[model samples]
Target: MEEDSTGPDAEVGAGAGRGDDQSMRGLVEALARRGELVDIDRPVDPRFELGGVLALLDRGPAVRFTDVKGSALPVVGNVLTDRERIAAALGVPKSGILDALSAAIASRQPTEEVTVAPCQELRFPAADVWREVVTPTFFEKDSGGYITAGMIVAHDPVTGHRNASYARIKPLEETTGFVGIAPNHHLSALARSAATAGRGLPVAVTLGSHPAIQLAACFYLGLGDDELEHAGHLLGEPVRVVRATTSDVLVPADAEVVIEGVLRVDRPVHEGLVSEYHGMYEDYGDGCTLEVTAVTRRADASVQVILPGLAAEHSFLGALPIAAGLRHALRGFGCRATDLAVTLSGGGRVDVVVALPPEQRKQAKRAILGCFAAVSMIKQVTVVDSDVDVWDAEHVQWARTSRMRWERDLVLVPAVPCDRNVPMQQDGTVTKVGMDATAKPGDRAAGNELAVPPRETMDRVHGWLTSDGLGGKVRPTPVVRGALHGAHEDGR
Candidate 1:
């Protein structure tokens, strides 16, 4: 991930694991406890070096930028980059994340409204926000600094229901900037409704909320559904929300920073070189602008920024949510999906793999259809037996190689709708492929049994490998025919 090697060599800080505290700071402290955190106490330019440093640390540990050159607020990254880390954030075993998310969706608890919010500890009315607030350029190819991690809290103009979703906000001035929004997003529909009514849509961009809130915001619920309610269930309590200073929008009370603004949907500006989940840049063009009205944050705020586009952190955000959704959808189809994995090379939005028990092999087709039906962006689907570790890309490929016959196991659906991020997308559609990689009835004849030592021998070997005297006392050199190799190299 250290694609750019021009950054400085800084001091390393300790762990950045997750713990009982649901707050972003708490997550950082947990990482600190586990010695999985990288703390750069030295100064690093947010515009140039910060993103590179984060990219280099991708999929490894959480990073805290103690001193961001000109900014007073410290920045943190890579908190939700992998499954193990995210499972820790929710205080659940990795296997339980899907069930936890499903429960939250079904049994949502309402949020608590409060008058006092830590985010409002210090407040400023409009203008000079780019300098005062947190906006970092993740890459040099980026057109400018962006709010890569903030959740846009807005209300649907037609239904008057609140919406929380992620979008890219590039600050061009003290009060205004371009917002990259997908046309199909609920927030975009709300903005369009507001534009048709000849009114501006008010929004409060919340940064550095709890991981539960961040994950819940990405749920593919209905337009009017309150994601905060589901977030509360994930946290095992209510999420406190406070009214925005400039609008009626309710922002997370415990947020690290909140930029209250009204989006001007009628005003569309060209967004140059914006990064996509596919780890590439595309000129999406015509990004809507937001007029910053007020900024509120903690006195000693620690801003949270996502290393967007291709990074593990970015891909995991999209992948984890999809995993939960696919699991739920499959259950309704009479197939119990054991686990799911999104191929990282597919940018977490293209390829999906679903795992099932050997007994559920008959429902493989149902599981495949459930995936493609639930998510239009998925390009490829693979169904494997539960024994296959879905998370391991190599293992998934091996399952297909060992168990599947291309002619019989392949299911191809042509002219399916695909997202623009896919390279093969043509005329708004692409061909979808599904592979069934479960053991067949007569597979044992070919190579059903793997080549390995007996179970008793393997257990004894494991004990020997872990024994204290295993390395130092074992001076045996294996003999090839009559010659003894690796002998007397250490004067044995």
Candidate 2:
């Protein structure tokens, strides 16, 4: 249930899992050794070319842009595109990701601070440095360049507890950028407090961190929760942090790049049209502004970039933590959430699939409401029996079609708080829908049995796939999605 976090210098032996690498560079090298890295030597432009390649190569290998047309620093994209990749990053099987993340969040570990850090190897003044160093525009949107994968670190003004989360940073002036901080996000709330005191919020933007730490930053914890501690637990060791040069906020010791800045409460900047995780452009108007004070990086630092809307990286990153948080919350609410998944089709934020027990069918509405309350971003909830595979979209859809009675099983909540950008939503309110996709306890005999292949046959097919070098090219079908046979009685 717990593992030691190995320092950056620790060597992970051959056949080690992704968890063995706790630094960005370490994961990069590991991926390279496993032939999962795509090294691009050709010089690419940062404005649209680098992002274009990433978009074109979505769901493909992790890309390393070895050459940038204008800057000396390289860029990497699609660090973890799909759920399988996310699972590998967390050092767990795909089926165990939700439990692993939930458990990690519950058992927090203390973070260890170090004196020297590789991230500070090269230091530069903030003035006019961002335009040259930070990544350029990812998409051809109306706005300028943005940092899509930066993990912002901020501390609670009253508690001093640190929190790390991902937000799109829109670089405007040479030393200033506008950050899209939703009103519900903890960072936004902290910024509000700092504003009332007539002071700026000290923050550090870390790019290119370990996969575990990167994923940990996405967890939807309480306001004062220390995400770094949860990240340590996920890593099986304490996260090593270094005091920033220009601020008290400590950044990951092995981060590829760190930008120290003060988020100004008095200076709010309007963000032009920008792409969001929903695969669409929306103008969030007048978000928080940050004045960069310092920028530091490794001598050969490689900037991390996530192509917004095009790849599953953005959706998958948000989905896992949301599901994990919801699972934790539902369990606390007395619901047996065997598994949870946030579907990509829902843009990774709006829809969720939860698997529970047949006997708990009556409580499905409670579970649905519990999830919506736990994760504010979720707009639709689907509850299925424990036998369902929430990760398989087809299986979930099948369950919805076969088990859900639209008139009886659908629960609709009107005028609920929702994202402002949702279509046709003017007052930030939307109709939330919950579907109970579980078979009736007494009608179990009326359901059809799933027709699945024999284990021996599937195993042989998998072996053949590996032998033919198509192991990565194809995935074994989700057996649970097999066609239904004649009606059969089964125990609930």
Best by TM-score: 2
The total number of steric clashes, by the backbone 3 Å criterion, in model 2 comes to 5
Clashes of 1: 11
Q: Which stretches of candidate 2 lie over 4 Å from their true place?
A: 1-21, 156-159, 421-424, 441-446, 454-492
Tens digits of per-residue lDDT for model 2, 56-136: 888888999888886768888877787655655565655567778888878888888999988889898998457446566
Candidate no. 2 TM-score: 0.89
For residues 17-42, could you state the per-residue lDDT of candidate 1 as single tens digits?
21233357666676787788889999
Residue-level lDDT for 398 in candidate 2? 84
User: What would the TM-score be for candidate 1 when compared with the true structure?
Assistant: 0.87
Worst 10 residues of 1 by lDDT: 1-10
lDDT comparing candidate 2 with the true structure: 0.76
What is the Cα-based lDDT of residue 278 in candidate 1? 85
> What's the lDDT of the predicted structure labeled candidate 1?
0.77
Clashes (N, CA, C under 3 Å) per candidate: 11, 5
In angstroms, the error of model 1 at 487 is 41
